[model samples]
Target: MNKIHIIGLGLLGGSFGLAARRKFPELTITGFDISEKNLKDAEVLGIITEAKENPDSDTDIILLATPADSLGDILEKTLNEIGENTLVIDLGSTKSNLCARAGNHSKRKQYLAGHPIAGTEYSGPKAAFAELLDGKVMILCEMDKTDLHLKEKAYQLFEALNMKLRFMDPEEHDRHLAFVSHLSHVSSFMLGKTVLQKMEDDRNIFDMAGSGFASTVRLAKSSPSMWAPILTENKENILQALDGYISNLSSIRDLIAKSDGEKIHQELADINKIRDILDLGRG
Candidate 1:
């Protein structure tokens, strides 16, 4: 793409600009954000070549990296104003809502629904780095609805960033992500809350916390403004995931309470096989 516009200069948007610029130095990247500081920071850090109040009409690509809940409205408005050949891509966490919003738009073919399965538990332009998306999964939903040329263009850009591609239905994407991604964030946030509540009684509780506790609760530090909507948008699947999680926790609790050491060991040992599934072999 000769010219690209990015809306929402947060971690994902900024990182995309950085990687795109590094891969294609000739590309002119312009960024816009509701927060003036974010736009300014992106320009100053060289993540984007310029800061704009809105996307330029003649740009070849437009990327939407706004909060998940706000994506539907923003994507609708973006498609209305984009050039006939310009491709628009959204990097929102949730897809079904955004895809549904674009379903009847005249420029539907120009729009691509995507989610980059990569990030740190950090936000803002300052937290972005070019290597953030390298070797990451870029999931595209409803590709059949997108124009062939536009889809090819998107594939080229994603390929340049060293992303592996996966195609999934929008509904299926949300359902699976609800379990693997959304549910994990909810668990981390609640785990952090549980510890903080206990720390009220034991002031130095964190002092005794180990690396495992720190790692497990890391996602609790993620942006609430970003995650709150994702958890709610995928509420159905998340609720189901929560039900299974709670049931398992209860089962484990009962095992410990009854001192059923054999079953508990078997349960944990079976769960430990996840390492093999994850390819974290012999670590």
Candidate 2:
């Protein structure tokens, strides 16, 4: 049986372990985590056959499931330990940096940079579920850097997990993710912060928080430690997106202040067309 070693057994890693084991019972799975609590939780949930503090154990594949900021360091150490036959893949949000860092390594051809665009506003082992990656998109960045055999291995694994695969350059991945994913996280976090600040005196947040508010602020519940580094890493593109969003908000507010009904109606109508373009349900 092939052995799969998962480092940093948090939500992403833990979920992968569970899903992989459920789908491929022949594979032996082991998990390693820096946090003892996370390791205990993974063991309790049967996400892995065993939990280890060291990642140097023998395994056919190593999944670096650490935060975006910590990926480089973990990859450096993991490369030093794993055999050439072991394929290393990272489940990180920001891929450009990690890809560059691993580019010149001796085992670079064995490493694949992957980002599964599937997660919840939660973290840690207990937050993992077997269905987390089901029907979601998995972005594989800079695949050319990986050997053909390793790439095929990764593709098959993600397919077995029921995820759709998409190829992307690392730089392009970061740029596009900044708008679609990172910006959403920022908007959600700031929205929640703004509401909380207002509620300091109002104390009626729950009253005003209908489904709309809940949906908009959902990502705010994400782990700050996980998001902070991602936002910082993709700061350039995120800043540009934020500027445009703020400018639009200011324009809308000014229109409302001036009571320019015609202009406001026109502006909303123009933007509402997005529902048609994106195939979203009626607003």
Best by lDDT: 1
lDDT of each: 0.91, 0.87
Stretches off by above 4 angstroms in model 1 are 206-211, 280-283
Write candidate 2's Cα lDDT for 12-32 as tens digits.
Answer: 999999999999998888888
Error of 1 at 183 (Å): 0.8
- For every model in order, what is the number of clashing pairs? 0, 0
TM-scores of the candidates in the order shown: 0.96, 0.94
Evaluate model 2: give its TM-score. 0.94
User: lDDT tens string, model 1, 8-88?
Assistant: 999999999999999999999998999989988999999999888677878888999999888888888888877787999
Candidate 2 residue pairs in clash (backbone atoms < 3 Å): none
At residue 234, give the lDDT of candidate 2: 82
